[model samples]
Target: MHTPADSAVAIQGLHKKFKESHALCGVDLQVRQGEVLGLLGPNGAGKTTLVKILTTLLKPDSGHVLVNGWNVTADPEKIRSTIGMAGQYSTVDGLLTGFENLYLIAKLRGVGRRTARRNAEDLLARFRLSGVAGRPAGTYSGGMRRRLDLAAALVGSPPLVVLDEPTTGLDPESRLDTWDAVGELVAGGTTILLTTQYLEEADRLADRITVIDAGRVVADGTSDELKAAAGNRLVVCVAEDHQLDAAARAAARATGVTPMVDRRARRVEAAASDGPAALGRALTALEDEGVQVLEIGLSRSTLDDVFLGLTGRARHRAA
Candidate 1:
């Protein structure tokens, strides 16, 4: 049972270092009870390190972490008991059946033998893995294994669950199924702290988001709030391959900011306060200059835009 006022997780001035790399630098965050907080950052941005610290798997060199009002350092054992974690890799044993894997976790969580069996079976059915419960986990597809891993995390019925890139390798359908499961857990009043590189996933699942770059928090807010802070609308236009430079110039003149040109894509992208009107002006200007427009549209600012603005780089590898 968690009180509304009791924060699910709280960290203050958290710092960690490995060799010369500063993994976390003066990081501070809080996740309210029953809320889903998304941690977004590029690789080497300290998202996983923060999750590890909160889950009591690693200790910060300085600062404090409190989970359910218990200090992580002073009450590590208690914190571990209250928290469940599923990392990027599935932890299901390849040699064991899905049911056996879940059964082992239930027993480890102190459930009686009969209860463990019942719990394992129920979880398998709930995750829609009962059909393959007897099959060795090694034979499971990527999506099935991910579902099993998530199911195992719930064996303890922990109040808080930390998911670090839980949907990294799943197909679109699998990701949607996983999202539904997460929603169901949240609806049941479980607090979740999710770390992911997928902006769309964060937008879909998080109540609040914290964006970290170079080991420090660069932004924190809801998805819409962060996007608003990133500035304004973006207008993208594709032109004939040979006319890209002229189109870029036209866009710059219309928007009063130099547009970014992607020669390979024959596209020019620029930001503007009023995207639709700006795009229309740019298009008209381009046509006046004898430049043929292929396509044009105004796009809402996204978390990716926020990351690029703050970090001076894209959050993920270029597609």
Candidate 2:
């Protein structure tokens, strides 16, 4: 039987609106205990709105949301106390040093000063920020500040951590560091609700992913399952940009799915469920259309392919 202990987060028939525009439409998703749930959507896909509702910053128009088994409407305070949140923007005070940021948060959570100090030290070490633990957060590098922000979120050791675009603007190295920290959190049995537009993040971190677009739940599964459901990608690279249109038509004809056109790359991609047959058909269509094919292949579908197939657009990823 489904119960509070089984799901760290649960939503049923969720709906929300801002004036005439619908922000969420009967969306439902769940995060299993001690697992990471990646929430994926394009901008304005009700991700932020859902995060707000889960964090008790906004109330849903209608729906049942349970966090750690406590109803959102009946227990906002309980939910807040049990879940830690880190947004795209850092919430740490610039004036506070790394240790101070964590220490203060621990204190605010009602820990004794001595215990808060210990918690701060432990977190700084865990995130590899102990070397600059005394430096003001504003003076830290972007990555360090982000690490500190993450540390602050864990001050009270909340069972569930909601991370929204946690690595949005980090350098590749810094992003890796943040990802490592998240992995550590999971290893320690913390449940994570991660919302990110970075497809790679979802692919690597999420135990299960729930994709929403245009205010509705569109897809949900493990990364491999979503990719498998997207079938294979029939990719064609024409010799010239001018051939893109014909190539798109050929891919469409070959796969019976609309093709994604990349003019700059002189590439056309489409989902091909029948890999061998689709490749054969594409080759014929290209030859018939007098298109110069530089490369043609049927490759396994990627998470990005699954995302595009469901949402009708590519997710913009950070470098």
Highest lDDT among the candidates is held by which one?
2
Error of 2 at 298 (Å): 1.6
lDDT of 2 by residue, 88-195 (tens): 689999998898889989989999989999999999999999999998999998888888888888888999999988888899988998999999898989999999
Model 2 collision count? 0
Q: What is the C-alpha local distance difference test score of each model?
A: 0.85, 0.90
List TM-scores for all candidates, in order.
Answer: 0.87, 0.89
Model 1 lDDT-worst window of ten: 231-240
- Model 2 scores a TM of 0.89
Error of 2 at 253 (Å): 3.6
Winner by TM-score: 2
Please write out the lDDT profile of model 1 over residues 41-136, one tens digit for every residue.
888889888988888889889997888788888999998888888887888899999999999988888889999999999889988999999999
